[model samples]
Target chain A: MDSMLSTPRAPRIAEQAAQWLEVLQRGGAEERKAFAVWLTESRRHVEEFLFMTAVDRVLEDVDPQQRIDVEHLLTQGAGKVVPLPAERAAAVSAGVDRVEPAGMRRRSVMALTALAAGCAAVAVAAWGLLAGTGWEDYSTVAGEQRTVELEDGSLVYINTLSQLQVRFSETGRDLRLLQGEAMFSVERDPLRPFRVDTGSAVIQAVGTRFNVQRRSRQTTVSVLEGAVRISTEAQTQEEGELVAGPQQSVPDSGMLQAGEEASIVVNGRITRRPIAEVARVEAWRERRLMFRADTLQDIAESFNRYNRSPRIRIEGEQIAARRFTGVFDANDPESLVAFLGAYADLAVDESGDELVVRMK
Target chain B: MQTESSKQTDGLAGTALEKYRKDLHRFLVRRLQHAEDAADLAQEVYLRLLRVENSEWVRKPQAYLYGVAAHVVFEYRMRTEKEPVTFDSEVMEQLAENPAGVQPDELGDRLGLERQLERLLGTLPPTHLAVLLLHKRDGLSYEEVARKLQLSVHTVQKYIFQAKARIRMEWQRQEAQ
Candidate 1:
């Protein structure tokens, strides 16, 4: 039981589940205390525990007939197919990546299927997501940044704590930004509409790139490169609903053009704005914050997005309102504090979980 | 305990349920394979949110919502615990439409994924599969499985981990596909 928790290659979620199951399987005071702490680490830890419990129950009851069928399929699949040299070369030489041993095995299988299934067996993004097959989910933990490349040649730059599911069907490419922010440099597909959905709003791309940040109240869709159609659920539900928006909301919904940005709020109101502050909006993904003629409060707000501790506070409206402009590492509060101390003749007090500033 | 740092973090992390109702439901729909179940799960999430005594330390509300949604999906699937359940139509259609054999029609792509899952499962050593099947299918606790099979709990757990790992890995591997 103890050894189960330390397995080297188990998926992190399953491994954490093993560790959690071990605690539940064995009852004790110290173990419970530690388990409580782990559970508090994130909502994820709790979900993993529940997931394991369900997976445990479900797999056991997999109908015996189905199990037999699967067993038969496994044996049959071993000698599944012999790929032609041409297909083999396409499988291995073509840019289809084999990053892991499992994928390597599947690539051979994919090669075999491509030859055998013809158009019928074309790999679809729906397969991966539906079955937990090959659909890759890219996410960042707190304060983390990651860049992921999708199978359809699309690139996703995931901002901190963001959850993005990259799903591509034969006819369409879809990215679901579950939370946080992600900038998608979508490769163009004419037949396959590339749609990025942020729950309330769908950013449809004809052939372009954009960013979607799902803040609590408003979802900001910013286009850095090309035009994107930002559609909200209500607008899509009743076209006139947005068309009746005194007139600006509907037409703009068709194309959120390059250098333009729009916010989709909870009430289904669409607010479009030119991305004049592109430098500032684009900086956090690069691990830095750029401010131009922004107030100390605004700078403080930007810094707050990146750090959980050492909060920055300006003393008064005069100090908070003073406009400052600079580029600083997103993770470093001390640098900003030092800069403030020197630039504004302020005193920087670094104590416990906060960095407070006031005029000298 | 409410400090300036906490306020700032709250702004970055707090997720009002209204903001992501559609997204949460959609996630459940994908996983649960039923819109009604997804809606029920979404409402459950909202109720859970309402019951939260302190929203502090509940950082990253969207991630948190999905976390809750994940549990809801698992729980929804598990509602039939110990009852014999066949592979989902999704799973069956996938099996029926596998590329090596027949013309899969519309279901081929999804059912075709069975090849990947089976291939991954087939790679596990027999011992690992046995332990996992016993634990999962027979509903035996690790200790019970170990005792029944005359093996150590450590051995039992190890194989279970291996099987679970393989399934999880294949699912993830497909993510990148």
Candidate 2:
């Protein structure tokens, strides 16, 4: 080769180094011993060996998919004319129902990329998954809030203690709100209805701003800006009859307008509030938790959601029965306790793992 | 001398670096003086050992290894401008073995190597490129590559070597630029 001619002895060492790599990879004890002797001959041998191996590693790091020529050849041999991944992804989002062979192959590749050692491959595929039916699950911790921009240009403001699984099919944008609350600022698409499944019901919207909160006893839907269609799951006739004493009374799921809210219970029935009570419902966003004459125990639980240590515990029936009305910082437990002490004429005790409130 | 299995990043047990790690650590400690800095440099030496593309070049791997460690010490000196460290003549003598200083750039690190590699990989001949891809990307053994390509093992070795040589040429050329 011209390269060998340009550098005569370097090539010889290169071959020698390559041979040693081969031996090191596969050869027995005798060959390895022979290899150790060969390395003793020159300093260049080790350096060249290092050079080859490092470059090889770099090559290994890059995806074979990047080599368009090779991928083209492989695709042809498989008896298929394949479009590039980017092109196929674009077609998919443009409402093309036909799945390209390459697109399907890429889907598996994308899945493998998630689990594979090659992180870069996964990164490449992650961006393309927005167009495909690739469902991605997202969650936020107790004190953390996250905003995710969906492929359909919808923005999901994930609230604390929330888990959501999102899937974008050709016809619709699907979401399953596993727990907690999320405020969605959806982008309007006539072709697709943005839907959230909360086990009890499915809230469908063409484009709207709304919040879905899954509470301890029931799932609540509060519409802040636009109308959302609440379709509760159908309850069985026998179960309904047992609850209603041999009378089947089916409750209808309805749409909630801006400043309207609804709660869906276990039997797939809804309780509607005429007004959303927007300021009270959305107060957590401003860190200004609003409670009106709530029980001391209930208020403590609200404050505890934002605090970690020194849990709030109301002592005695007198302290627990006290009415509390205040807008306090969600994150500031000290301020809320201080407010109770000053205004409610309550004795506050900070001792040994609990913040205790007692009737003074 | 036989070394223990290495605890390096690549996780190949019983590498020469693993066996003689204490010696290498002591060597670094002597020059860097600070136990932590020496410890870091010693780990870097092991990492480099683990990353050795061709294990064959390590004939007098012990000597060749010290050569790498000695060079790392020099590079460490080139950095740490806040510290006025002196390199004795003996240390300077060993520096002659290593001439492959990475090309300088504004980013001053991996970006330069990536640029140089990209340019060089493009310039390499098809045979050399094929061998490089097979050995590096495909992670094929020389015997396997030989079998696949219908060539002798020696010829495959030559291609791998040539591929390496061509890359080195390109890197050196970048340095000259």
DockQ of each: 0.06, 0.09
Q: What C-alpha lDDT, on a 0 to 100 scale, does residue B169 get in candidate 2?
A: 46
lDDT per model vs. reference: 0.54, 0.56
Show model 1 residue runs off by greater than 4 Å: A1-137, A234-252, A277-281, A314-322, A343-345, B1-177
Model 1 residue B55 distance off true place after TM-score fit, in angstroms: 62
| Tens digits of per-residue lDDT for model 2, B110-172 | 334445456677776655565566555444445544554566766666766677666654544
**Model 1: per-residue lDDT, tens digit, A1-360?**
223222233367667665555443333445455555565554445544444443443343232212422222323433322224564466557654444322232333333233324323333433444432434588887668887756554668898878887756554566677788988876544335577766677777643457889977889988865566666652322311112121134443545666788888877678988998766666776688788888998788667767887788778889899898889998998889878867657787877888887787
Worst 10 residues of 1 chain B by lDDT: B1-10
Deviation (Å) of A230 in candidate 1? 0.7
lDDT of 2 by residue, A1-360 (tens): 123222324356655554555445434457555765654444355444544444443443332222323333334332322334664466468554253323332333333223233333332354355556466899986567677767655778787778998977544577878788887877654334578877777777644568888876788888865467677643213311111111122346576766788999867779888652567766665556788888888788777766666678888987787787888877777887788778556788899878888877
Supply candidate 2's per-residue lDDT for A115.
26
